[model samples]
Target: MKIALLQMTSGIDPDVNAATLETAIADAAGQGAAMLFTPEMSGLLDSNGARAATQVTDEVHDRVLARVRAAAAREGVWVHLGSLAVEGDEGDPRWANRAFVIDADGEIAARYDKVHLFDVDLPTGESWRESSRYVPGQDTALVNTPVGKLGLSICYDMRFPALFQALSGAGATILSVPAAFTVPTGQAHWHTLLRARAIENACWLVAAAQTGTHEDGRSTYGHSLVVDPWGKVVLDMETTAGLAVCEIDPAAVDDVRSRVPVIAHRRAIPVPA
Candidate 1:
């Protein structure tokens, strides 16, 4: 299957972002892409928790999601709406950072809430407390798609190898890690972490990324990537708003795992006294 990774620099406006995503989707479909993947916060990027929360609505009422779902059905393609900011609960100050998988019929097949929140104080003088505004997901998501068996995860989730292991154990052959990584962390650990995750699990890692600066006064590292089961970066997107389209064969997953058999050689660690 041919998948397209959309790299975007979205502002704090869901409408505009939806339009951008629509165009990308059409273009991708025009180029014969079977599946299209987007980055985190694809709807909006906001620094103000209040404004961000207000802009997000319930998933059923989110216009961007509705539009993209319609796009998937119209284009006869599958879509991974990487992650969207949506209203969480009644009276709760926080919202949900959620990902959705849309089938060719424009129906939501699976949804994954991001489990690992990005709460860090970076040396670059850029600090974030994502847990403050967003609620963490309690469960991991593994779903089936036309491309392969998918394991869902967001940006910060990539740092936790255990999550990937759990997904792999649950029969996930393709891992989706869409991120809006900060410039500093992206520069330091982005590629390495992604490569490590793919090598460790021997799974195809497809990551769509956010690039450049947003209207929220923040910059992001924008190297969207697709790593094969053997940890080969077949496609690397530039630091701009564009599509990185590549073909992925699921048979490679079987071949790699057959050779390495790492997942089968697992042993639990012993507790120390």
Candidate 2:
């Protein structure tokens, strides 16, 4: 299947982001891309937590999501919208970091809420407390799509290997890691971590990233990558905001797994004395 990874620098405005997404979706589809993947917080990216909270809305009420769905239907292409910061359903005012898979018919096929929250103080003097603003999700999602079985995850989830292993075990051949990585962390760990996940899990790793600086005065690392099951970097968008399209062959997963067979090599460990 042909896939397009959309590297973007989204701002706090949902309307402008939606318009951008629609155009990319159309362009990708016109180029015969079967699916389009976007970065996390593609709908809204603002440095101020309070402003983001107020600007982002629930999934049903989010015009950004609605617009993407419409574009998906019109273009007849599958859309992995990466993730959207949305209001929590549990009466808590904090929003949820959620990723969605919309089918060509514009129906939401799968939804994965990001489990891991980023809360850290970087040496670059950048600090974030995501838990204070967004409620964490507890489940993992692997969706069946035309391209292949998709493993769903947002930005921070890339740091956790266990999640990718579990998704691969659950029959996911293509792992989607849509991210908005901070400059410091991205520069240090982005490629290495993504390659590790792909090699260890024996699955295709596709990460569409948020690039450049946003209206929030925050800059993100922009190196969107498409890794093969064998951990080879097939396509890389280096600090550019554009579409990176590549073909994904499902057979490659099986071929790599047969050669390495790490999953089958795993053994359950008993509690040690």
Candidate 3:
């Protein structure tokens, strides 16, 4: 299957972001891609809590998501809409960093709320408290798509190996890790971590990323990548805000797994007394 990844520099305005996504979706489909993957916060990327709160809304009311879904249906392609900041359920004041899988028919196939919250004090005098405004998800999400069974995860979730283990164990052949990562950490750990995950699970890993400085005054390490099951870097859109396409061979998963057989060799670790 052919898939397209959109590396973007999203701003504070949801409308502008939506238009960008619509255009990218059409372009991806025109290039004969079966699906398009977008970076994190595709709808809006704002660091200011006060300013972002004014634009954030529930999934049903998010114009960006609606536009993307419509575009998916119109283009006859699937879309992995990386993640969006959305209002949580009634009585829950906190919001959710959510990812959505929209089918070609414009219907939601699955949703995954980001489980790992980025609450850190970076050495660069930058700090984030994701838990302050969002509630972390408790469950993993896997859905069937044109490529294969995809495991859903956001930026911070990539650090947790147990999550990937669970997904791969549950028959996930492809993993989607959409992120907006800080320059400091991205430079240090991004490639190594993603490649390791794909190698460990013997699965295809697709990561769409945010690039360049945004209206929110934050810069991301953007090297949107696609790693095949054999740990080969098939595609890399290095630090550019645009769209790129790559072909994925589902048979690679089975071929790699058969060669390594790590999943079958995995043994449960007992808790120390």
Candidate 4:
């Protein structure tokens, strides 16, 4: 299957970001891609909590999501809209970093909130407190797409192997990990972690990333990648903010799994006393 990954330097303006996504959807479809994957924070990327709150709204009221859905239907393509920062339920004061899987008919197939919040103080003097503003999701999401059964996750979730293990065990042939990673961490562990996940789980790993400096004065290490089941890097859009397309063979998953047989041999680990 042919898939497109959008590497974006999302800005603070939701409207602008929405337009960018709309165009990318059409472009991807025109290029014969069955699906398009976008980066995290695709709608708005503002570091200023006060300013970003002005644009944040409930999922039903998000203009960017609405536009993207319409575009997806018009183009007749599936879209894995990475992650959008939106308002949470009533009286919750916090927001959600949510990812949506939109079908070709513009209907939402599944929604997955980012389960792992990035709450780390990096060595580069950069700090993040994702839990401070967004609530963590409770469950994992797996959905069928044009490519295959896709497992959903966001930026910080990449660090957790258990999440990928669950997805693979549940018959997921593809994993979608959309991210807006910091430059420091991305440089250190992005490629290594992604390859490891694919190798261990024996699934295709597709990661769409946010690249370049953003309007909010933050920079991301963008290396949107597509790793095959054998942990081969088939496509890599390094540090470029644009759209890139690549072909993925699902049969490779079967080939790798048959050779390794790791998933079948997986045994439950016991807790140490």
For model 1, the local distance difference test gives: 0.92
Per-residue accuracy of model 2 over 1-273 as CA lDDT, tens digit each: 799999999998989999999999999999999999999999999878777767887888999999999999999999999989888977797889999999999999999999999999999888899998888998999999888899999999999988998999889999999999999999899999999999999999999999998999999999999999999999999998988789989899999989999888877778899
Candidate 4, residue 44: Cα displacement in angstroms equals 0.5
Misplaced by over 4 Å in model 4 are none
Candidate 3: misplaced stretches above 4 Å? none
Give the Cα-based TM-score of candidate 2 against the true structure. 0.98
Q: Point out where model 1 deviates above 4 Å.
A: none
Error of 3 at 201 (Å): 0.5
Kindly indicate the candidate among 2 and 4 with the higher lDDT.
4
TM-scores of all candidate predictions against the true structure:
0.98, 0.98, 0.99, 0.99
RMSD of 4: 0.6
- Cα-based RMSD of the predictions, in order? 1.0, 1.0, 0.7, 0.6
Model 3 lDDT per residue over 40-66, tens place: 899999989999999999988999999
Clashes of 3: 0
State in Å the error of residue 239, model 3: 0.5
- Which residue pairs overlap in candidate 2's backbone? none
Tens-digit lDDT track of model 4 for 1-273: 799999999999999999999999999999999999999999999999999999999988999999999999999999999999988878899999999999999999999999999999998899999999999999899999999999999988999999999999999999999999999999999999999999999999999999999998999999999999999999999998999999999999999999999899999999999
